[model samples]
Target: MENFVLILLAIVIGYIINRLNIFSKDAPTILNQFAIYISLPAMILLQIPKLSFSIDMIIPIIVAWIVMFISAILILVLSKFFSFSKEITGSLMLVSILTNSSFLGIPIINAYMGESAMPYVLVYDQLGTFIALATYGTFIASYYSNKNKITFKIMTLKVLTFPPFLSLIVALFLIGVEFNPVITKVLSSFASTIVPVALVAVGLQLQLRLPREEIKPFSVALIVKLIIAPLIAFIICKIFAWDNQASIVSIMEAGMAPMITAGAIASMAGLAPRLSTAIVGYGIIISFITTGFLFKIIS
Candidate 1:
């Protein structure tokens, strides 16, 4: 409960900051850069080195991917009803299929399912979720933007420099090294900032206006995110008969709001920003009610 409440509080504070115009949009770029360069690397050092993978992790991973893939396919089916360009349709489908299972997923699981779930969650973030985002996400965004043409140089540069990817490599290195006090201190302090800065960064980037006409599209997107996504996770858990703890963690991570990174990618890809923002905001807001009741039920 402590973890869940803290994350919610941070998100609430972010919304407050956004409404108040605490900083211009320009300020968060630095924070985003800091998170990418400093906080993210620190987090990778702390979590990755300490991680130990397992075959059991594979079950949740496959479940997660299956759920996402199914949802993406569903979005494409629904897109036929709309008149959106292929780029917009692809971006919308991308966001619909993906969830924010990492930056925001950790604290929620830690609060409800306990720290035991972290390894499952971490591996999901690393290999399962991140890989999808890099390949599928980039493909959708770039394809929509008419930039899908890839040279070896572009692909190599993107994969190598991605912050999370870099962190994953560093973490693998940490697996064999002796833990040291100096590294711990630096990583601990810097990593501590990820949650707060990230939420506020969400706030900083948010613009509240959207076309009321697109409310139809927006609601459809949110329903997929908050309802369909979590339901699939729970159903997968039940089908596979995931044990109690893993089941709860699966639901929590799977229900997570849309990826914030999706917003950046969508904008860069020239997708509908209003639709993306609406999806992200609605998912976070509803998560409190839905996730709150959910944990109580599981408990």
Candidate 2:
């Protein structure tokens, strides 16, 4: 409950700050840069090294990948059907496919399923959503933000040079090697900033009154992210006969709000900033009710 309240409070504070003109228009961008550059890497270093992969992790990991891949393809086709611009298409790609599987997923899953289910949540998060944010998120930001024709070389370079991605690579190698307490503490302090910072960034740009043109895309994004994504995960679980806690966690994670980081990345890339922030802002609020109903149905 406290976690949920903290997220909402941070968003409210950001919105209030925006109204007060306390910061320049570049405030959201600066906060996002902090999240992507400093906090995200610190989180990766702090958490990834501690993960020990196991056979049990395969189901949630595979389920997460499948949901994202299918969702991405669907969003592309729908964007073309609706005649969305390259920027809108790119924004939808990031905000729809990547989910708030960690920030929102952790507490919500823990509340519904208990501590034993947490490992599955971590598996789906670190191995699933986190990797997508670093790779797919970076790719979309580069591909859409660039005006010139992009090549595989440039995309690869962008992903490689992305700070969080670089940290992920280093963290993977450091697995099984314990860090000194001082180093761990430092990393934790920085890592803790990711959620609040990202949420505040989202709030800073949140738009309540939308132009008629944006309504369709916003509605489409929410339906895809909060509804169809989880439905797909549920069907996959049923097909595989995964009648277990891991499957439950994976399905719920799929239904989470648009990733705070993904929306920040989309806005940072100038991919319809207002629409991206609105999708994230409204999505998180709506997810509270949707996720509870989802838990009841699945359980």
Candidate 3:
């Protein structure tokens, strides 16, 4: 109930921001920059360094890999069935597979599952979703854009250099190191702001529009992402692949909706703005329904 209320509040606040123009046109750029360089790094640092490694990352990775892989396959099939442009197909693939595992992901998990949920979500996103986005997603986006060729080597470098990715790496190295009281306090304060800011950003970013061609692409993404993904995660859990918290965690991650970052990237790459916008908006609306459903079932 609290989570739902918070989401509602976020939506109202976001709508207000959109109406008042306080964000101006530049807010998205500034927010993305802040999230990447500041908030994301702070949150990653707080989580990564404190843990022993888990073999369980394998299942979640497999689950995530399967989700992304299936997304591509589905898009290819969608191409056959639906006749979207290459750019639109690329946009759909990016949005469909790359769940919003960062901004909105952490908070939603934290709220329903607990702060302990952070580790599972981060490792899954860092090792799986984010990595896939950097390599596979980038390749598709680049290929469709066809401006310049980007090699795997350059792409790997770019991935590693991203602030959150770098922070995750550093945190791994710092594992077992103890933090002083003052340092812990500072980090706690820094870590606390990620969720609220993200929800606000989500609200500010929301838009509704008529879907071209009946928005069939969104309906497909909505079903696959919000429904099918969680079902697969549940099967993995029930099969004894992940137990209890880990199962819940994987389901949480899998249940995530489209990453708005995908939309931003699609727009930046100059391919299929219309499709990207639909995926972002429609994905969120449907995600609210599915995430709540997953939370209830998992609980």
Worst 10 residues of 1 by lDDT: 48-57
Candidate 1 lDDT, 1-299, residue by residue in tens: 56666776777776777678786757668777787777767776776665555546576677778878878877777777776667558667766767777667776666767656765676677666777777777777777778558455665677787887788787876675767889788878997787777766766665556678777667777777777877888788778777565566667777787887886678666788777776776666667677777667655
User: What TM-scores do the predictions have?
Assistant: 0.86, 0.78, 0.92
The TM-score, computed over Cα atoms with residue i paired to residue i, of candidate 2 is 0.78
Q: Candidate 2's residue-wise lDDT over 47-91, tens digit each?
A: 667657664558889999999999999999999999999999999
Each prediction's total of clashing residue pairs, residues at least 3 apart in sequence or on different chains, is 0, 0, 0
Write the residue-wise lDDT of candidate 3 on 1-299 in tens digits.
67667766876787688879988876666666776687778877887666666766456677777767766787779767888777777777777778888777887787787777787788878888888888887887788898769897989898988888888888888878887879777878877766666777777777777467747776777777788777877876787656767667777788898888888788778767777877787778777778888888888
How big is the positional error of residue 93 in model 3, measured in Å on the Cα after superposition?
1.1
The candidate that achieves the highest TM-score relative to the unseen native structure:
3
Judge candidate 2 at residue 148 and give its lDDT.
46
RMSD for all candidates, in order, please.
2.7, 3.6, 2.0
Error of 3 at 2 (Å): 4.5
Candidate lDDT scores, in order, read 0.72, 0.83, 0.77
Off by over 4 Å in 1: 1-5, 81-88, 147-153, 176-178, 244-247, 297-299
**Best-to-worst ranking by TM-score:** 3, 1, 2
For model 2, state the Cα shift of residue 64 in Å. Answer: 2.9
